[model samples]
Target chain A: MIRRQPPALVRRAAGPVLYRLARLAGGPPPGLRRGRDFAPADLPTVVVVVAGADEGSCAEVLDAVSRAQWASDAFTPVFVVDAPVLSPFRRAGYVVELAGPGGLGAAVAEARRSYAADLVVVAGGRGPEAADALTGLLLAQRPPIEGPVGRSRRFLRAAEARLR
Target chain B: MSGAGPEVGRGAPPADDVDVLRVLAPDEDAAVVAEELSLVAETGSRGAVLASSPGLPEEVLALVRRGVTRVLRPGEPVRAGAVVVGTPRPEHDLLAAVESPVVLGRAELPAGAAALLRALDGRLPGGRGNGPEGPDPVGPGPVAAGSSGRRRVLLVSSNGSGLGHLTRLVAMGRRASAGTDVHVLSMSSAVPLAAEGLLPYEYVPSAGDLGISARRWNVLLHRRLGEAVRRFRPDVLVFDGTYPYRAVAELGDRFPGVRLVWSRRPMWKPRMGAVQLGLVPRFDLVLEPGELAADLDRGLTVGRGDALPVRPITLLDQHELVGAAQARTALGLEQDVPTALVTLGAGAWHDVDSQLGAVVAGLRRVTPDAQICLVRPSIARSGADPGHGVRTVSAYPLSRYLRAFDVVVTAAGYNTFHEAVAFGRASGFVGVTAQLDDQPQRARWAQREGVGVDLDPLDPSSVARVAELLVDERARERCTARCAQVWPGNGAAEAMAAVEAVADGASGRELLGRAGASEGRGGREREASR
Candidate 1:
């Protein structure tokens, strides 16, 4: 199980906090892919949690972000999925780690604490316009958040303040 | 008459004592809880029903586990503060149970049962005074002044390799509906088909897919099962599965009013062993859906004198089948071209698409004019393009369009096998993986009975064999003739009658063996007269 855990760099971005929360929600079932180095650790992590499944398209978003200003190892863009979509990111040569089974709120809260997340982005659901705005702000490296970002920002703000 | 109804529900809502929950014990008008909760569910009301079983009925205890209704001791205070029916408390103060329990002085439960039902209904969000409500009136169907009457049948089925268990439940539920209201609770994703077949159904989702610990899944299932029982207040609960779950025993002992019938199919492979057999006696009755291979059955669970065996039950009726020309037009094939429906059943669950693709592709070569249609409609929805010029037709009960095809190539599943034989549609069985149901055994039986052909689905030449059998008029006619001789179209009716008989207190091996009626009906009738 330790061998399957995220690499040292990923462990740095995602503290043991997320695993504890997932354990409470009954953790990922057997065979669910564990953390595989998703984003770089040098930059403050920007955890992107996909609320609905459709993780492939979202992985493409992360891939696009990494190619642009985000830079592979700059700001860690950890994807928090309900289920895993590791292969697409792996194929695209982007380091995409996953934390799951826990709902989005729990995943984002833990991400904020573990990474001192500079921003948390939620995108890819029913609203297309909102997804575009978040995608734009994220690629452009906005603050903890400003565009159409939803509830996770409040959690990140509080976690950042508490850390300070 | 409802004076003995057990009440167990959760806490009362704020302010109004009438804001109670719904729990149904054996002696109570079971639909009363469903009727009440259906309202609360609609009105967004949140609370539980509170009632006490001084005798502590097993039925009431089970409801407590589901948190459907709160159970109280004989003298314990009612928590939900719902209606006080009859003389439940000869010892305790009703006022202590709640700020104001609805206790009617000298009010006969037979008389107040109506008002008690209405009081709970009136407290809902869009009550008579609150706003305009929908068509269904809240309470139990307006009972005749002195009659404690209402009948709800609960049909529960476990997931099988295919729709066999669920389809049989659907057949039994539809037949049971002729005399009683029926609701189905299915543990398969295909549960939506129940609604399409015109039965009210709830999908519990198969536990196998949850990826959780067994203990946790069991607890969740126990609570869900209890809640379904409480909501439906079924007089008869038919659990149709290969092996009975562990909770059925406890549930049976508690709900004395619910006549538990184990609606099982025959053909359990000898290797499955007798572990499930030990639990059969826990049910009020064991219903075995008769198979063509009863004589060949080495299954330990079914076919004993203690179990009732009816004709092979199927969801399709002969009269309901679409005419070949109409079905052909609907399916978009020319009348002149031969059509073969490769209805492999839920074998699609396995990674057999590539294998089936080869079989169908091979089939298209043998019978060039034949239009091949794969029966896995869900494949396209799952985004798998089964593109070899074989379109996917997803119509429910595929039996409705049985006439459209000259032949059907399918898995050796009970529903498909029974329907094909019953409808006299020539078919060839391509055996699929089944954990307990021995499809291979049934496939051989079907072939020997002259009703179908069977072969290993993966065999390279199996497609040619299947295509040849379908195109051969003589072979197809022989198969159809054998089918016509065997199917009696009485399985569902006989099963329903037997189930009702169990509810009416009929038991013993003699009663069970009487499943095949005196008229020598069912397949026997087909041989003798039809």
Candidate 2:
């Protein structure tokens, strides 16, 4: 029989172990924990989303996240690249192009639905208007995983473990 | 054993029968049995036994088993025979009944008794484990000249209130005097002299008497500081505060032969509006402690040293620092806990309350477990109470506490800043006094170098941000490493060499001619040279 440990001890041990495993796997650890009854059906397909007013910044974020090990088999990156440059990411097999020429809020919602994304990673300096819009949307949705992009892989791993 | 009835003392007496006894000395067997009986009475059971006793006192025998039966006669033999007890026997009745019993004969104790006594001595109230005997002497040795016929250098800092300027002067004097005579002139209470062990000149009276408004006491104290210079005439006069500008300028005119040097710490803004306006010019040579050179553009427009003087005058440096673990052990602190040091200059300002509050608040948010130590130069005199979670140490040698810190949080005072940078302790600056704008400016320079963060002492958010940055292990390590990179060692020695060259008149005419010729290039080139 498996002896049960205290919840506090299990939580403490789980975070560090998960972080180590994620590091070994060369990816940011997933921070959220699933319900006891969670199954394959409950697992929302993951996607990395890049939102910014500047197309250059958005492309950079898309390029960085796609290159990460986590984006390999674990999640698909949905680059909501503005109309300017959609070809580079499309050719990379990661793009699920959203149809309207819309602002950040529309881009985030469109990307989230199109890719069935469970987590959102925003990158680049979008000025105050985009920041407010993104913040408002994120707050309303209350996504299980969210953070600034371009942060170190180690920080992402730590953040993921904490959320879990 | 089957035939044995309830045993009575000495003879086969009836259980209900009573008998009075007078136990005498020298009856070993009987005394042992009587002692065992006493033990039974005391413990309320036969848990204890007297292995052997040479004699028994009459008073003790009478009181034994008092509640149960009468005492037995002394000549009566013990029916129980000699009882052998456990090594640690139970309490004896002889000791219980008699308040104070004086036995006449010599008492023989077991061999283990001596060892037991020794063990008890280890736990005794007064013993050898008292804390390290007394305060260790921390002051530096007397300033000595390295070469014979070396010029005597007198460094007088009239920057009363805060000893930051004064401390830098002392460190500079100590270094510069390696080939020259060094004396310090101060109007500060005798404490600085006593702590530094320097020859002090006469004291100037209150700032009010020196024509400085009570509001601007720093300026007034400096006005009267010229008295010290006049008294201790020397080859080189070094002034280390902003207030003593007029006095330093006057001294330069009064004794043209004497070299006047001003060591300016970094400033956030100019101290004197008039000086910023180019109304008054002070000092033949100005020494910028750290990166004051970068901010002031090497004192080009200000008529001061253009480059920062690289002097070997600082106490906190890599070679001087004790290893972090060793320092913690020496200071009796938990080896694992992160330590942070907070310090302010000697001056006691009215706004100290707010500044200290901000620091405490920031510390609470960032690293609550981080050990915080507050070091003030005049800890003994200021009596400034650093609140909870803060340990206040007097003007003990900074060298002792320098290595103990993983990070140092302090106001932008010149001496402490230089020390913090030199020692590679991740430092954070909180601007305290506006009288010396050099502090905030210095903090900015340090921030630019990635050595530390500069936070507005008055702003709660900024303080909290600094605290957050300091607690993060990665940030702290990177900052300290960067600080070590920026500050190469031996600044004090270099500054002193420059001062010595000027004092010997070798660089005087050349420097003056350069100062007069290009005016702009000379000052900037001079600073850059150092």
Candidate 3:
């Protein structure tokens, strides 16, 4: 990626001093690294359909997961996003992969097959739209197996059955 | 992205347009489309035209008929603009050809607008494609500065037991909306503040009041939140509560355009576990508005990791403050009178009668002619009629009528404690025993820092301290001096800047720029207290 334009930092006294101070405080978080360097070994692909609009939301979720010990060992955050969202996530220190033109469903299947994963937890932008996206992914028959979504009791039972 | 308002001058970024590329899944709701159009009109953004879906629902067509800028038929000469949300109107194959930002905030009107308006956010005026405005700015602060449209902020207040959440939000809203359009969707009784013209507000019933299950509350909250977002179309959605409602967090995906900033003030008693941190990731920024007594803070989230700490965000901002003389005049009080303001917050004080009597006694002892003003919830609620000896002041935000008092005696609650000190009044913080509050800690901090007197009404020495603070000019001056030594009263400015940064999609602590002086003040205060 291109070395992006400098960010805008507003201080009462505009100078390099405040900028260096802000820099000294810290970078993103402990777990965040600046690269696409996650191993293929992190299994059970977690499909994050990050919206270009509020790209920060997905980044925040990933940042949280990064803070959690050993969470990166179990889940791989796969991104189904437009161009604007990719750089921020990458810069924040997570290995990122982009979704092709076939849309999210095809992308989920491809990630799962490539990684040989047991489950694919899918989430989309909120409200009924999220439920709709999950339904689309789970109900697709080409995969021959319907996976579970979320931690609801019903989904848990389905996930248990799938695992069994 | 806020620069989308029509007020933006010519050659400014083209943010004033409804640019959602709605891909109708053949069987889409026309009402939703019409709602979107209405929302577009509401924000003064040029409404969108659906490209592919023909045979419009009559309601959607009516929007066009009613001068909605109508849906442009496919292959028609369409006004080209940035697409805000959803896939291209075409099927899978055509999606590759459509080089437009996808529909991220499908349910959220404001979030959708965030994504769409952002197309114009960093770009220079008169062009759409990415130009050399330097490297494309990322994170939340960039767009906060020079922008085209009015930066719309929807401040959501959690309906907690205390008014701390709502009051803090009001302080922030008043300051943030100075150059932005701010609306409050309060889950508490603070809807009345809207009537007073503090800011445009709508009341949504709290989950506790509604008596719904947590899951059900999330559903209702998201529904209400989505509706509010539709109406407000905020670039930034601020959740001012201890914890964000799950539904509100879930809306992140549906309305990816709107950046969610969590303004959580930590003073949690009972030593909360890490359960609440689960939601931390959902926010674009978890802004911890610094507490004046933050050193004494023992709240679980008070100094927990991952949050950007700002200055003490108090309700009594400098710009909106009332001077001592003006406040006395407004309340029809004698300017030279040694008036003691006993502001026992709206919390139910079991010994309220005795509390008021003691406060009055302290004032009388301080000076025989000293006036007594007890600022409580309301005259009806408190039923505090002490004849003419005590005046009942029921300012919605007592901060406005604060200068009416020479000394302020109040509960050590977050808002009142901060307000008294921020207004530069010699204050007495009476520690009220309350669940889930850090009043005791606040009271101790006040006493330690010499910013105010910590009064435990029942304690003789505490009452004596109050009396001394009221009458002793040196004591009052010392307290005022200590307060002046503390952080600058620009918490609202810092908070608004943070919100602006988040809305702008610039990451990192650009808003933390001016915090140098604040940190220095804090360091000195800590050293002085030690």
Candidate 4:
């Protein structure tokens, strides 16, 4: 999907204010532990949203998160999913929170409120394809893959490349 | 040694309670004491020698050579806050003369002197009770000796044109004593610190990188640095950059306990960087990495006594580099073929494509089969193709593989300039225009010293001339021979000693201030004698 970014002036003025406001709005979930003492505090937090109790999607997203390289134990990860799928992620030593009754939007909001992640990767499918897409989103957290393709096409190309 | 009774010396007590130590050594161990005193003076502390004879002791003269000029009359009353080191004598009791903070016997010679040195280094906590006959107060003072005594140091590097600032800080961080814990917070993207196991490294984006205004970026810097200061609780904070950010200067007032040292490299563009020099006094120490072209230095910091001078700091020592064949294999260049490495810095600050093209054309024209390797700086925004036969190799501290190339063509930045000469590689220097660095002067120094030829990128003839020298065997020998004659030993270890001293308690401001005052007094005394 192609999206237009806000003007540079607006971003320059509002970025820090919004960051501070978001930081103040929510914090890590009640029992969610802080990262290790030496871990950089500015690492982009990650929120993985998995719909329903689809075990395949949960497993795929979990696998992608485990393999990503943002430094060993550097970023904070919060998985928002159906209550039934929470055990696997929890057993994997990740912070797992059950999605509220209000569905996807509410689940994302609650996760954001709990972890304040900078990037969100949604997992809604049930195969290796979904995991590949999740991996592309994770890679997009960097300055977006540099190449000859259009901005929208770059992400899609990244996803396609990962699939192959 | 005027036989008069003890009288106090000029100057008030240091507010931080660090005493200007007076060592009264007996005749036998003077040489050993002199060696230790030179190390102490190197850390930015003045050593006072109490002598009664007309001729000074070897230790006292050694201290003078290290820029300490304070001499005390034998019977001068020891001032308050001055620690006394002397032998217990029958007629004269040095301890009983005045209320000394701490007195040491000669039996505890070097070890006792070392403890006092550590105390002066600011490694010890302030306001510990040390009476006239105190139990060795220097024993495990503030920063102790064992594993528990490891000093936490926070090194901050700014995003300069290239990795000059970050490289210098890394040199110090890697060479720091095992008892020091180092954390780096850099604005440069290519920190490479975590790879070295210098953990807890953080990257803060530069204002240009963030597309933000300098004002707002400074605000962000203040918050980020303040947060790091609180979390790291560093005993010493070292910043290496031309401009000491207002946020960094403010750190002193905010965290009084954290000793701040500014690792400032000199050879600034003449009359440039004066505004930045105003912040030098704000720091506890201004560590000036000595420039090879010191005589040619026309910059603002040229005559400044405030900064403690150390040898030119290079990340890799000469011994650390591999042999030519080994380096060639590592870089994948074939043996017996001429190769030249062109690293003109990151190309982010200034575009070097036209210059790079000229060099390639020149090299190909002179030596067709010569492998031309360009260093793809880690911080460069994007890599451009350098035509055919030229490959890009990335390496941290490229000095490690410097031997692989017969000739190195580079801009005269602090790190690359020193590394090329110190490693004794034949080189051509292109003086790139920089914000504050005096690159042209460095290139001129190289030419004058006969170590390298200065080339102009825009001038095709000059590029062709240097390109010929690159493949010429005899020219290469002349350059390397001159390099051997001119290269000063690596100052990384000495620079680390200064940092450790400042981390312990030696204040650059106090030491330099006293140095200036003492020089002033000596000037007046010489005039009176004349």
Docking class of 1: incorrect
Residue B379, model 1: lDDT of: 14
User: In order, what DockQ does each candidate have?
Assistant: 0.02, 0.01, 0.02, 0.01
Candidate 1, residues B1-530, lDDT tens digits: the string is 01211111112224542354343333555454444444443444444444443444454445546655444333343333333232223212323444322221111223233433443334322211100011112232311111235466778888722467888888877777455777877776456554454787765434453322333334445545665666567777889997777656557654566778898788887857578777878888888787876666776765456677678898878998999999888766668677788865444422446655666766787887677777654312333435555666667767888898888887777788788888888887866767787788778888788788776645657677778876788888888899998786649877877776765567735565564455356558658763
Q: Estimate, for each residue in B1-530, the C-alpha lDDT of model 2 and write its tens digit.
A: 01211111122222211111112223334444355345434433322222224334553445443553234332233332111211111212222221110110111222332232222222111111111111111111222222457687777665433455566666666665555777766544332343245443333322321222232233222323332334344667777665454545666554565667766554435434445224124456656564532544322224453533444357434665667787776655566667777665433233436666557556765777767666644422434545555655453556555767767778766666677777777878865566536466667777777887787545767666567665678887788778766665756766666677777874544554553566467578879988
**Model 3: per-residue lDDT, tens digit, B296-413?**
7766775456677877777766557678898888866777877888766443223435765666665665566777776645312434545545676666666887767878888887
Chain A TM-score from candidate 3 = 0.41
lDDT of 3 at A94: 48
- Model 1 CA deviation exceeding 4 Å by range: A1-126, A129-164, B1-148, B345-354, B379-388, B457-461, B508-510, B516-530
Q: After superposition, how far is residue A18 of candidate 2 from its true place, in Å?
A: 82
lDDT of each candidate versus the true structure: 0.55, 0.45, 0.55, 0.62
Which candidate number would show the highest lDDT if scored against the true structure? 4
Please, what is the TM-score per model?
A: 0.58, 0.45, 0.51, 0.56
Error of 3 at A91 (Å): 54
User: Which 10 successive residues of model 2 chain B have the least lDDT summed?
Assistant: B127-136
Q: Candidate 4: DockQ? A: 0.01
Model 2: number of clashes? Answer: 22
Question: Which lDDT value does model 2 have at B185?
Answer: 61
Fnat for each model: 0.01, 0.00, 0.00, 0.00
- Ranking, DockQ, top scorer first: 1, 3, 4, 2
